[model samples]
Structures are given as C-alpha cells and as structure tokens.
Target: MAIIRPARPSDAEELSTVEHAAYANYVDHAGVRPEPMTEDFSPLIGDERVWVAEHEGAVMGLLVLTTRPDHLLLDSIAVSPDAQGMGIGRRLLEFVEEHARAHGLGEVRLYTDEAMTSNIDYYLRRGFVETRRAVDQGRRRVFFTKHLG
Candidate 1:
C-alpha cells in the first residue's frame, strides 16, 4: 500500500524529479510542457497544501491542493511513469475528496490541459463532471468539479 502524507521540505527535490518524469511523456501530446513539470516544489512543499505518496521510502507521486472559500482546488497530481499502474493516482484523488469533506468543504475542482485525453476520461470515470473550458497559461484547459454530500 502507498502512504500519503503532508510533504516535508526534504521531500522537495525528489518530488520535483518525480513530477518531471511523470509529465515527460505528455509534452509531445500537449505541444508544450505541462505546468506541473516546471513547478518548483521546494517552495510548494513549505505550503501546507502539498502531499506526497510513497512506498518503501521512495516517493512515487504527489498532490498539490489549494483551499478556497467554497471548495478544495486540485491544483496538480502526478504519478511517476514507473509507478502509474499501481493506483497511486486514484488513491491521491480519493484522499483529496476525503480531505475536503473532513474540512467541511462541499466540492473539489480541477483543470487539466485539454490535450490530455486520457486524463479527461479518467476524471470523468472517477465521478467528476465537466464544468467548463478555457485557455489558461496559453494552454486550453478543461475544468471539472465533484460535489460531495
């Protein structure tokens, strides 16, 4: 099983490396580097919002969440290429919803580059609904929201 916890400053370097590797395969598909790939995790790790997923001492994925007045924002999620098939991504998302509800939030929201087709399908299958589309940071984005009761 993978363990998920708040990120520590020391985990920043490996988190950044894991993020880069996770998004490397999507550059060609997006025609540009995805935002997460270039993010500096060192600073983000200090924010209480960053979470890490690991197995046997090796970081395998990360979740960056931002809290809003009405909902939790799923800023970014990445699972290293080598760890993709083991369900870490799904588990991290599950953690997001659970975290949101525990904090008295009603929903979770996220946006992804529209070119990431598999991501679109995956989110839909996971119970998120498409709320809108827009271009952000020069990339076309599909936004999604999941309402929790």
Candidate 2:
C-alpha cells in the first residue's frame, strides 16, 4: 500500500534523490537538465507544496503543487525509477485532482518538455488538454490544463 502525505523537512534529501533518479532518463533525450532535476526542494518543503508517496515507510514518488487563485499547478510529479510501472504516477495525479477539488479550485495545470511525447500522451489520455506551447529557460514546453466541474 502507498501512503500520500505532505512532505516534511526530513524528507528533503530523499525527495532530491528520488527526483534525480526519476528524471535521469530524460536528461539524455532532452539534451539538457529537466527543471525538476535542478529544483531545490528545501523551500518547497517549507511551503507545504510537496507531497510524497511512501510504501512501507519508504518514499516511492512525489508531487509538487502550487495553488493559485483560480487553479492548482501540478508543478512536478516523479516516481522513483525503481518504482516506475507500478501506477505511482497515476496515483499522484489523482491526488492532485482531489487536492484541487478540496481546495475549491476548478482546474489543474502543468507543463512538460515538448520532447516527452509519452508524458504528453499520458496527460491527454487522462483528460488534460494542451493549452499552449512556449519556450522557457531555453527549453520548449507544452502546457496543459484540466478543468474540473
């Protein structure tokens, strides 16, 4: 069973480790570091924007969310490489939608590298629609949004 909870200060290091391991596969394809690979989780942890998916007390995945006045941003979601193919990513995304609904937000938004076609398809299949495309930090990004009624 996996438990999803708010990230604590002590989980910072482990979160970083998970992030790096999860994103390592994308670095080569992207030809640059993925934003999540370089994000510092310390401040995010303090802000309670980070959540971890733990299995038997071991962190297996994580989701970072930012709440705005009108919607929730799914800033990042990563499942440890060792834990991939086990539906952790899907669970984390579901959690994000639930969290957004609970907060009275009607939508969720996220962005991913344009090169990650698999990820784009994953989100599209889950009901997210591409909102636009733009370049950020020299990387082409595909933005997506899901409206919740």
Candidate 3:
C-alpha cells in the first residue's frame, strides 16, 4: 500500500538521496544541479508544503508544491528509480494538483529539460502543457503549466 502525506524532517535524508539519483543525469547534462537536486532538503522539505509517498514503509516518491498566492509551483517531483513505472510519480502529481486546488491556486508551474523528450511526453499525458522554453545556466528547459482552476 502507498500513502501520501506531508513530509517530515526525518524523511529529509532519504528524500535528498532520491532527489540526487533522479536528477543526476539532468544535472550532469545541464552542467549544474537544479534546485530540486540539491544535497540538502532543508530549504524545501522544511518549508512545510512538501509531501511524500510511502510504499511498504519506505518513501518511494515525493512532490514539493510551493505557493505564491495566485499560483503553485511544482518545485520538485521525484520517484526512486526502483519504484518508477509503478505509478508513484502519477500519484504524487495528482496529489499536487489536488493540493493546489484546495489552496485556491489557479495553476501549477514546472520545468524540465527540452532534451528529455520522454519527460515532456509524460507531463503532456498528465495534463501539463508547455508554456515556454528558456536556457537556464546553459541548460535548455521547457516550462509547463497545468491549470488547477
């Protein structure tokens, strides 16, 4: 069974590990680590808006939603490689969408590499539409938005 709930500080290390593994390729390709792939979760998980998906007593995935009154930012979403393809990512995303709506946010924003065609397709299938593209620190990224309102 899998359960989604607010992330606790105790889960920080595991979340950080998962974040690193999930974004390692992107980080290397981009020549920089995205904020989400940082070494510590203190800045994010400590913010009180992040959530995790626990399966069989271990956290398999996580989603961090940062709000700015009018919009929601999917600052990060990651699933353990061992747990990928099991729908953990999808569940975490759904949780984010629901949480955004509950907070009265009109939309959710996120970004992924333009080079990651698979990721783009996955987001599109999940209702996120590309809004724009930009080069951030030498990395080509596509911004996406999913309306929650």
Candidate 4:
C-alpha cells in the first residue's frame, strides 16, 4: 500500500532524486531540461507545498502544489522511474484533487510540455480541459484546468 503525506525538509534530497529520475526522459525530447528538473525543492518542502507517496517506507512518487487565489496549481507530479507502472501517478493526482476540494478551491490547473502528448492525453482523460497553449520560459506549454465543483 502507498501512503501519501506532506513533505519535510529532510526529504529534499530524495525528492530531487525522484524528480530527476522521473523527468530524465524529457531532457532528450525537449532538447533542454524540463522545468521541474531545474527546480530547488527544498524551499517548497519547507512551505508544505510538497507531498510524497511512499510504499514500504520508500518514496515512490511526489506532487508539488501551489495554492493560488482562486485555484491550486498542480505544479509537478513525478513518479520514480522504477515505480512508473504502479499507479502512483494516478494516486498522486487524485490526492491533489482531494486536497484542492478540502481547501475550498474551485479548480486545479497544470501545464505540460507540448511535446508530451501522452501526458496531455492522461490529463484530458482525467477530465481536465485544455485552456490554452503558450510559450513560457522558451518552452511551448499546454495548459489544462479541472473544475472541482
């Protein structure tokens, strides 16, 4: 079974490891490092904006969320490469939605690299609708939003 919990400052190194392992594939395809790969999660952890999915005391996946005025931003979701097929990503996403609902947020929003068609399809299948596409930080991104009401 997997346990989802808030991240701590001590988890910084492990979360960074997981983030890198999970997003390494995108570096080659995007011709640059994915945004998540370049982030310093230590501060986020301290702010309680991060969560981890652990199984048997091992970190399997993680989600980073930012609370906004009207909605929560699903900043990043990453499952360790070794744990990819175990439903960790789906569970983490569900957790994010529940967290949003609990916080009285009306919606959740996320963006993915335009090149990651599989990820875009996954979000759409989960009821997220495409809101727009734009170039941000030199990368073409596809944005999606899911209304919680």
Candidate 5:
C-alpha cells in the first residue's frame, strides 16, 4: 500500500515525471498537453498544497488541492502510468473529500478537460455531478462538484 503525505521540495522532479506519465495518454485526445505536465511543483510543494503517494520511496501519485470559502477545489490529480491499477488516483480523490470534511467544508469541486471522457465517467461514478461545461483557458472544460453532509 502507498502512504499519502505532504509533498516535499525534493520531490519536485519526481512529481513532474509522474505528472507527465499520468497525462501522456491524453495528449492526442486533448489536442494539447495536460497543464500539469509542464507545471513546476516546487511552488505548490512549498505552499503545502501538494500531496504525494509514496510506495517504496517512489512517488506514485500526486494531488493539488485549494481550499475555498465554501468548498475545496481539487486543482489536479495524477497517478504515474507505471503505478496505474494501484488505486492511487481513487485514494487521492477520497483524500480530497476527507480534507474538505476536516476543514468543515461542504463540498469538493474540480474541473477536467472535456476531452477526458474517462475522467468524467470516473468522477460521475464516484458521486460527482456535472455542474457545468464551458471554455476555459482555450480548452473546453467540464466542471463537477460533490456535496457533503
């Protein structure tokens, strides 16, 4: 099992590698690379908004979350292609909800490129409902939110 925890600055490079692999398959589908693939993780790590799943000292997945006044925003989530089928992405999504509850937030919201159909289905199956769809940053995005008790 992988352990989830705050990401350290030293994990930046490894995090980028994981991000790249995780989104590589979506390049052709999205017609552009996923944003996280070229993002710099050190800043997020320093601000403590990033978390990592570690298995045997290797970063298997990462999550970036932002707390809003009424809900938590799941900025991004990715699991290394090498670590697929290990449930890391699911665990990270679960952590987003747990974090929201712990912070007394009522919901968790996230958006994905509309081209990522698999992600839309994944979130829908996990109880997230589509809130809307529109163009953002020149890409069509589908937004979803899950309300908590």
Candidate 6:
C-alpha cells in the first residue's frame, strides 16, 4: 500500500535518490545532460503543497505542486524506478487533481523534454493535452495541461 502525504525534511535524501534514478534513463536515452536531482530539499520540504509517497515505510515517490492564482504547476513528479509501472505515478497524479479541485484551480500544467516520448504519451493517456512547446536549455520540452473538473 502507498500513502501520499506532505513531504518532510527527513525525506530529502531518499527523495533525491528516487529523483535521480527515475530520470537517469531519460538522460541516457536523450543523450542530454539531465538536471541534477533535488540537491537540497530545504527549500521544498517546508512547502505544505509538496507530497511524498511511502510504501512499506519506504519513500517510493514524490511530487511538488505550486499553486498559482490561475493554475497549479506540477513542478516535479518522480517515482522510484522500481516502482514506475505499478500505478504509483497515476496515484500521484490523481492526488494532484484532487488537490487542485480543492484549491479551486482550473488547470494543472507540466512540461517534459521532447525526447521523453513515453512521458508525453503517459500524460496524454491521463487526460493532459499538449498546449505548448519550447526549447529550454537547448532541449525541446512540451508543455501539457489538464483541466480540473
């Protein structure tokens, strides 16, 4: 079972590990330098909006969402590589949707590198539509948004 709750400062190290492991393959596949994982969670750990997933007492996933006046930005979403295919990501996504609805946000937005086709497809499958694209740091990233009911 997995429980999603507010992140704690104690989760930083493990969260960093999970973040790097999850994105490393994308880095290799894209042949581009991947952004470093959360080097320090001090800035994020304190945010009430950040959440982490724990399964059997282990940190399996984490997501940070920033609420804006008009929208909610999905700042980060990472699941341990080993936990990737088991619905953890979907669970987190659902949680974010609930969060947005509760906060009266109209939409949720996120961006992923163009080379990460699988991620793009996953988001599409989950009801997000590609609304824009951009070249950031020399790499193309597609922005996706999902309207909250």
Candidate with best lDDT: 2
What digit string (tens of lDDT, one per residue) describes model 4 on residues 15-118? 99999999899888878888999879888988889999998888899999999989999999999999988888889989999999999998999999998888
lDDT by residue for model 1 over 1-149, one digit each (tens)? Answer: 79999999989999989999988878988778999988888777777889999988899999999999999999999998889899999999999999999989999999999999999999999999999999887889999999997
Q: After superposition on all CA atoms, how large is the RMSD of candidate 2?
A: 0.8
- For model 4, the stretches where C-alpha displacement exceeds 4 angstroms are none
State the TM-score for model 3: 0.88
- In candidate 2 the C-alpha lDDT for residue 11 amounts to 95
- Compared with the true structure, what per-residue lDDT tens digits does model 3 show for residues 1-149? 56899889899899888888877777666666766776467666677867889999998888887888778898778988889888899888888888888888879899987866778899999999999999886778899998875
Worst 10 residues of 5 by lDDT: 29-38
Q: For model 2, what is the C-alpha lDDT against the true structure?
A: 0.94
What TM-score would every model get versus the actual structure?
Answer: 0.97, 0.97, 0.88, 0.97, 0.97, 0.93
Residue pairs of candidate 3 with colliding backbone atoms: none
Q: In model 4, what are the clashing residue pairs, if there are any?
A: none
What lDDT does each candidate get? 0.92, 0.94, 0.83, 0.92, 0.92, 0.86
lDDT for each residue of candidate 2 in 1-149, tens digit (9 for 90 to 100):
67899999999999999999998888888888899999899999999999999988999999999999999999999999889888888899899999999999999999999988889999999999999999988889999999997
How high is the lDDT of residue 9 in model 6? 80
Give me the runs in candidate 5 sitting further than 4 Å from their true place.
none
How many pairs collide in each candidate, listed in order? 0, 0, 0, 0, 0, 0
Where does candidate 3 stray beyond 4 Å?
Answer: 27-35
TM-score of 5: 0.97
